[model samples]
Target: MHRTYSMRQSRAPTASQIENPPPPPSSTKGGRLFGRSNFGHAFRKGTAGAFGPDLAKKLSQLVKMEKNVMRSMELVGRERMEVAQQLSLWGEGCDEDVSDVTDKLGVLIYEIGELEDQFVDRYDQYRVTIKSIRNIEASVQPSRDRKQKITDQIAQLKYKEPNSPRIVVLEQELVRAEAESLVAEAQLSNITREKLKAAFTYQFDALREHCEKTAIIAGYGKHLLELVDDTPVTPGESRPAYDGYEASKAIIQDCEDALTNWVSGHAQVSSKLSTRARTLSQRRKNNASKRGEGVDLAGQDQPMKGDRDSWVAATEHGEIYQHGQDEDEEEEEEEAEGEHEETNGESGGGLSLMQRIGLQSKE
Candidate 1:
């Protein structure tokens, strides 16, 4: 009968043959191999056998679509990796650009800070200057007003009639007012000049002394100290006064007091010098009087005309006469006396009446 052999009776496989079986013949229907010991073949056959031909064809198409989708995913992953690398490079460039910008910003901030400091310093200086200007204006305002008033008074007086009875009195009043105004203006000018000089001198002396001390302390030598020390040294003299800054009113009274004292001291010195000169001139006159005392004007006995002439000649010549009997001396004295008298007459004749009156008044 058509009975198949049993598995044990078919053939006994060798040990190597059992371990490694021969490849099975391929099947054309399902594109699979049969009688294969491989698990891949069984898996495919199971899948194909479980479904019909139409279903298997649809599954195969689905698997092919999955493979295409996986390939596309791989391509997308590669493009993402390239894009990430480009982004990393751009980030590095951006970091460098940010660093440069940060440095520039820091420098700009520093410049702005310095400019702010300068602006503050300049503003303080401007404020001080404006204050000083205000103080100066205040100081001169009263004087300017007085001068304007005096000028108006003088102008009004000038319009009066030339020969009016009140004209002379008005003219005198105007002159006095003008003189007072001039004195006031001069005093103001002197005050301003002196105050300025004092302020400048005070500041200069302080700075110079400071420089001198610094130079000495730093061992810059005595020469540098001397060069920097420009303070004027006056022996046996009072120190000059300083009114302080013009903007300050506190020291103005002290300044005025000092100026008055200084003026008084100057006047005292001038008076002393003038007195000394006058004393010297008086002493000279006294010596001349002593020299003239030797001349005998009131004599009890009258001398002969010839002897009198000789004696007068000797006196006019400013010669001390030794009572000697020499003829040459007497003759020379007589000639000199005649010449002196003639010269005196010529000079006296030339004097005007006013000069003669002045001379008589002095006598």
Candidate 2:
């Protein structure tokens, strides 16, 4: 049999509740007709952050607000189920098509209410996790206060009695307090990160399942709407007798089956990011890949000046060698021309004009 969960009334315990019992959402409500007024919420809102240690006040307020939200959701779920029952009652005297459809819709809407109740339970899981953080914050506050108080005592003693032996004792106490505070701070950091992640993970998962199931119910409801004959008929002639009982039942059964079989892996809807988001994601991936490569490649990728220096040094060495060769060739040609001029006896001196010019330039 399909499970038809309600806002668990004050009746005999079900087998499921007996095994791993949790408080029903009904336990959180005011039991009165209209529930509590906003006055209680306003009073709580004004006072939540007014007490407690300064470090914990904000988180304490957040915890208080979450409680308010849970109570509100509980009220909403309870009222929704009532509305569903009223819908079925209103349709009891209508046509057969309207009657069956409204009854089936009531079932689905009641399921939504039940799901909301379940959501409140799961939401409490997140809220409880947050309260742990607030508790830790409150616990750590004492260590901070002790440390500050000891430091102040040491400062006052230094001014009144510089050589007081009690200053040494107080300083030692201050050191111990600081060490304890350090440990507390570290624990606070680690637990805060861990619980924050876990809390949100539970919340988003429940939300996804709830939304998907609601949409499935709506789709089936639309299918049920098709059974109604909207086409206009003659005033004197009545329309054919309605005979969509089996079809509507089949649709409702199909909806029940779909809801029963649904899972995260079988989810049909998907979310798409914007083009800019995709681009940024790709860029981050590229950066991560580049970082993963070895250090040698990373060094080559960097804009190092060593490469330019190495090339410049090689070019300078080549230029110096070529310049020396050219100088040697000029000296050899000058010697040969001097000999030729001497052998030809074409000048008064044995030196050629080129040699004389070279010597004059050197001088």
Candidate 3:
């Protein structure tokens, strides 16, 4: 009655139709060729009987095992990377320690060599002063002998003729001879034999002290070399089998001990040498001043200002009496600077390459 063409509802869909519906229409050529629904239906149809429930369950277990193996492999790879990074850092630290030890040993060797050089220089100065004193004595000996002969002749003449013109002329000649002798004596006095002797003694002592110190330093250096040489080289490796850090530390301690002993033993000797050197220098200055007075007297007669200026410059230079204090100060300053740099390097921690890379990636 409702136009009641509920036209008997079309017969219910058949079982096959209900289970496998027709594909939907597509708008494009590619879509028609391989539509999403068609692909899913085809896949399901193709695989429908390929595996039974039991086979699928076994396949799932195999897949899970494979995934677990992959995860384990990834975990092992990460551990290996961490170990490699640790080894790299340790190797770098060992290299840095070796370099530091080597540099310090080299500096010690250089210092020992410098001390030897100073000893030689001081020895040479001592020898020169000794020779100068000998030359002064030799020159004065002839003047003394001539003066003695003149005195003898005058005494003989006085005995022969008390008022003779020859006697008078001989007396005048004796006066001139005496004046020459006095001048020679004065020149000899200016050389200051006692001061030269003192200088020589100090230099000899200093040379001995330096020799002992050098022996100590050289022994320490040789020990260090031996230790370094004893390090074992492994096949296919550029570095030694052993890092030698502990050995280096022991050697450093030994060196410090040796240095302490040397300083203690030589401190007084050094002070004595310094004091003797200063005294000798003062004596030389006084002698030079007196010689300058004589030079002034000579200038009154010869008007030679150039010679006087040269003598003054020579005294002022005092090359013969110069000490190694300046050099020692420079060496101490250099050591201080090196220590400061080492401290700074130690205090300033650095990041590894991987860590830096990670930070950069994060940024």
Candidate 4:
């Protein structure tokens, strides 16, 4: 059996943004990774563990590999934004419905890319936490080496000068080194378990958020697709003019509202864990409880890792206005637009609301 969407990310700020306004540091979210390439990443990985102490070498490699993962993710996010802009550009010359829908689709896809990039920052938190584990491993290595060195000297003194006066002193040093090594090893064991759990817990929680929001966009994307009329017409017959402008705009507003209101407790999807999996998870929790242990990193009350408003709709006034028209008013507006389309026998005039407002989908 597989784990369901049981993981929840609950870190977004609950405070209203239009009132508080995001701080200036958020400008760094769209910062690009300059001069990065596969070759450079490979070189970094190759050298990571090569010169490190033997005990920490493998963990050093792991740390570098995680950096590689973040780099790849950043690249994907950047490329997706480019693709979204290209999609919008291509659709600009099409008919009104296709043009409007594709433009909105571009907005959604670009938001996806922005979400991905934002996710990279959250993922870094996990990577940095793992680095703590690597540091502990590296620190433990010195004690291990000191203990081994003392042991080797003891063996050499025994062989070279049996019953030498220095042998007893060396033996005493070995005892002290062994005790130090024991403390270091114990610290390493406890830290490794604690940090490993915290790191992956952070990763999976962020992942849940990323995946759920993308799914939300996908659902709205399907709605946008429905607005496009795909009816087949006779070669000589003229098709009716498109009138989905109001509908498409309303859908965008709805999407923005949905995303803004989303929280972990209200996640749309959930999985049904297998009996075995549930049992195993329960056992793990029970064992941790028996240890009388505590965790510091995973549950700390922290500000959001990324901006929640980054992916939502924006306006030209340096403010986001939420439209709250009733269904009757929406239906009336649609009917009026339909009449206008039929009377004109073409699309409406001038730039639409989208162009006027200028959605700042990216930074």
Candidate 5:
């Protein structure tokens, strides 16, 4: 069989036949088989082949999607960073506000201590005034009792004797005692009013200052609260800060009112005292002027009385000189008149005392 195969062996296949013949395209049931399409093969041979374009397009779309996702992530990260920065800034602001509030609270505590001191001072002043009034009242009682006892003693002494020096002394003592007692009673009443006035003045001043400081503290606290609650960005928005500010302003206004009232009252008191002091000064000046005038009048009267006495002495001396001269002249003339008197005796005997006086006057 091998010899016969050799004998019947066909000529060696050509180079083309040696290779296997190209397989036929497989047939599909209702259409051409899905092998490599001529159009697809031709397209693949060019730069824009169908499968190549589709693959490149898919790759391009995936790259674009990845870039979009990355961009979105980057934007989200930036937004988160901004939010975090805002939160950090807000947190710092909050810390500052808390610190400020703490400081304000400390100041408020100090102010409260000052207010307590003012209250204590006012209470002490009241106590002092009360003590002063009590002392004055006690002093007045003794003075009044002494004056009454002296008056009764004087009346009893009067009944005992009329011309006794004891009665006179007793009356004088009663008068002096009564005058002193009346003065003491009046002064006691005045002291009470003065004590009340002084106490009122002190309390008013202290309370006024206390209220002012309280207002300042309240204002500071309110401002601190406003800072605490303030919004960073929205200036126009209504917030707790605005309400706190308003409340602070109201407190300040109240303080102003209290201060105003206190100042006004103080001014009135000062004015009144000034008026009284001026009146007292004028009265003292008037009294001094009257005393000076009285002294000058007394001095002028003394000089006039001395001058009148001197004039009367001079007139008496002149009359004494005239009388001595007349006596001397009569003695000298006596020798010469002796002879005439012997002849005139007869005529003079008829002349009465009135006629002799008339004759002497003629001579």
Candidate 6:
């Protein structure tokens, strides 16, 4: 028996190990949790009939929790995308605001320079007035000295005991001339003082206007900075109504501003057209009253929006009848037809000896 006996068989697992399992189902892949095996089939058979009491409820809860977690992650991803988009819009608005501010600042600088030029001109005028006033004041003494010399000459003549009426009249004329000169000197001094005062006042006014304009420019710059810093982010909602509202608002503002500028430019053009029309109408009435002359005058009065000469033939002269123009046009057409017929005959028929002689003479 000891020489050739087979090894004894091992003992099988107990019924307790097969029935109530020590460990739960595995949570890893490639691990048998439910299948046809000694322990696995027993576990499946035990859990098969218990659907809603304990284990199934736990599995349902776990599935629901997994779905909720996946949904939360999706929401987080969408929120990140929305935030990125809003940031991009905010950055774009900031850039556009900065560009607009830069253009406006350039215009403001040009305006300020123009104002400075005006101020300098006014200051120069004021200085000229001051010089004129000093010069007039200096001349007052010379006029007084001339008057005293005239008085002394008159006294000397009277001391000569000249009872002539001619001498007395001459002295009286000299005295009147001296008195007029003094009066003229006083008037000139007053005029010079007024001119100097007015020039200084104008310079001061120009300076104040320039300062106000500069302050306005500065305020615009500050507003530009604020717009850049406070640029708001647009939401990701597909609100066509909101977008349309903003677009319409922008369009309305643009139209209003355009209308203002157009009115200003139109006013200037109207004034110029009025003056030109008055001058040209008088000239046209003085000149020929032909249809072409009236058309030219009307063209000058009512110029086109951009091209001024397009409607030059629309006006009729006061004295030139439409029938006359039609008759003249018909006569010109008849003459053209006769010339064309003569050319056709000359081309079709052989040239005459006179025509050949004339042609040779021309050549």
The top-ranked prediction according to TM-score is 4
After the best TM-score superposition of candidate 2, give how far the Cα of residue 318 lies from its true spot, in angstroms. Answer: 83
lDDT per model vs. reference: 0.32, 0.62, 0.42, 0.62, 0.39, 0.37
Better of 4 and 6 by TM-score: 4
TM-scores for all candidates: the values are: 0.21, 0.68, 0.34, 0.72, 0.32, 0.28
Comparing 2 and 3 on TM-score, the stronger one: 2
Please write out the lDDT profile of model 2 over residues 1-363, one tens digit for every residue. 111222232223323334435333322332322125666466556667565567877886887687678768876876887887687777667877776667667667776776677678777777767766665566566678889999999999999999999999998899888987776676666667877897787677667777888898889889988888777878897777888867766777677667656777777887899999999999999999988854333222223234211111233234432332233234335544444433232111122112221221221
- The regions of model 3 sitting more than 4 angstroms off are 1-102, 124-164, 171-196, 229-241, 246-250, 253-257, 260-363
Consecutive 10-residue window with the lowest summed lDDT within model 5: 1-10
- Among residues 3 or more apart in sequence or in different chains, the pairs in candidate 3 whose N, CA or C atoms overlap within 3 Å are none
Q: What is the model-wide C-alpha lDDT for candidate 4?
A: 0.62
What is the TM-score ranking, best to worst? 4, 2, 3, 5, 6, 1
Backbone clashes for every candidate come to 0, 0, 0, 1, 0, 0
Q: Which has the better TM-score: candidate 1, or candidate 2?
A: 2
Would you give me the overall lDDT of model 2? 0.62
Q: What is the per-residue lDDT of model 4 for residues 75-152, given as tens digits with 9 covering 90 to 100?
A: 788688678768877787888778778887877887687668767877877776776666556556666777889888
Superpose all Cα atoms of candidate 4 onto the true structure and report the RMSD in Å to 1 decimal.
18.1
lDDT per residue for candidate 1 within 229-299, as digits (tens), equals: 23566888643443222211112223223322322112221224588899999999999988876533334
Given candidate 2, what's the lDDT at residue 343? 26
Off by over 4 Å in 1: 1-94, 100-104, 107-110, 161-363
lDDT of 5 by residue, 82-173 (tens): 44334333333444444333333433333344344334444344434443444344334445666778778777867776567887777788
Query: What does candidate 6's lDDT look like per residue over 53-93, in tens digits?
Result: 22123332333233233223333433433443344333434
Q: Is candidate 1 or candidate 5 better by TM-score?
A: 5
Question: The CA-based lDDT of model 6 is what?
Answer: 0.37
TM accuracy, model 6: 0.28
Q: Residue 263: error of model 4 in Å?
A: 1.3
